[model samples]
Target: MTRVAVVGLGMMGLTHLNVYRSLSNVTIAAICDADADRLSGETTATGNVEGTADASVKSLPAEVRRCSDLNEVIGAADVDVVDICLPTHLHVRFGKQVLLAGQHLIVEKPLARNSTDADELAQAARSAKGLAFVGQCMRFWPGWAWLKDAVNDGRYGKVLAATFRRVVDHPKGAFYENGDLCGGALLDLHIHDTDFVHYLFGMPKSVNSFGYSKNTNEPDHVVTRYLYDHVPLVVAEGGWAMSDGFPFSMSYNLNFENATVDFDINREQSLRICEVGKPIEYPEVDAKMGYDLQLAYFIDCIEKQRKPETVTLENAADTIRIVEAEAESIKTGSAVSLG
Candidate 1:
């Protein structure tokens, strides 16, 4: 069995805890949150399988052992892996600790605040005997998996052009209100879509972007145009409409050489896939929590001694380079070339 410890019990942390409950081979050993009440409440409410359950909301049995300190959970004697749902900047720090403790590490996206930090963490992982994987969950999303398979099978014919949209209401405060972690939509939300674009087709040759920072200049939204070696890509945002004011969906369109693809990601189901021939239900094993698939894959990579499809240091840096270009374009209000 893979004994796991989850740190952070906020939005993403709680979600990770929920997913851990459903895994049979893996057991959630502990959960950490600064708030003792939060941890205890979640522990009792979720039945130790789910986090603090709110009758105000729905309920499920939680499996994680909740705590307040991150290290105490990850450093536990039986911990085989540490799944970090902490703030962005802390990814590298927590990752280093996990690796040093001889436990495999799984971090949520952006890897680190920037390419430089990501590189350093990558080096640490490389030197450590345990495996390290980033939580680029979109890669394992069943809809995307279907799309990639089809493209590789030649259904796309050559992959023409593709566009992505990810937006939500802007956040208030120091941006990294949680910690000195990575903040803003670019690193937080954009990384998923960017990872997709890069996976479907390698890195783009040039990137031009127009960006926006809420009250300050941190980039809450961006519209990026990328020039791929063989195709063109556009990743734009509707601005974060993450408030009660907006009724939204995270959807995208893919224009292939032979067919056009549209994905209507559902509220709680597999993404709807449509093409010229016929529409198909990709039958997503998970809708909201694809992290389970990701976690299992990473574990397979570690226990089986194989590298999973999550981003590598070079790949991560390359993605950030394009992201940086988008940031630049947003700043300059001009198109930036990729090369």
Candidate 2:
């Protein structure tokens, strides 16, 4: 069994802890959070294991350990992997400590603050034998995974273009509002779109993006144009600020030579395929607790000694490059070419 630790006590951090619980091979051996009370209380929270195993609406088993020091949980103990659910800026610092301690890392999106740090982490992992992988969970999303294969396998038939959109209400938390944290929707939010898009489309030749930021200190929405040879790419990104309705939403439209696949993780929870092979469908994901699959994938990667779909340092760097370019374009109002 692999020992696991949840490094933060926020929403996503709690989700990571729940995931560790559901997996038989992985154990929630330790949990560390700055908020000692929330960390300790989470052990008995009812909804901790509810959806994809996050919301419980029940009760937690006793005997769960809560630690206050990050170093004890990450460095001192025999934890096999440290799940860094901390904010984007903190990812690098914590990940470095984990790697230096000869432990593996599985962090949330936007692996580091900048491309240089992303590269350095990648190299550090190279020197550490126990180091396994780091990445976001979006690629493991079943609906998106199936469609990526369909397009790559020619089921989509000479795919011509693609579009992605994700929006959410403003994050009502101090961690999200921290200025020293990652920038705009570009870094924190759009990185998801950029990483997943890169996973599907490979590297883009150039990038052009324009957007405005909110006083809360991040772009609530953004439009990014990716240039790839002989392909059409336009990704519109949004998140958490357009909190007008009861539920936030995300949708994607994929144009292939013969058909189109429409997937809405928020609205419908199913993929609607048109013009070919009858309408394809996907299972609706529970938003509140759908993180189990992602955690499952991470455990699988650790077991298989393989890199995760969207969590590799390479993929992280690519996503960062797109975001960096987007910010540059926002400043210069000119398209930026990428290598």
Best by lDDT: 2
The TM-score of candidate 2 is 0.88
lDDT of each: 0.66, 0.70
lDDT of 1 by residue, 1-339 (tens): 788777766555666666666667777676677867556653322211122222211132365455677757766887888888777778888889888988888777778888787888888988886788887767786667777787779865776767777655544434343323444677777777777777777777767777666533366666777776677545545345255334334567777766776675544553454556776545554343356677777767876887665656557666776677777777787777766
Global CA lDDT computed for model 1: 0.66
List where candidate 2 sits over 4 angstroms from the true fold: 42-60, 244-246, 276-290, 306-310
Model 2 clash tally? 18
Cα lDDT, model 1, residue 307: 66
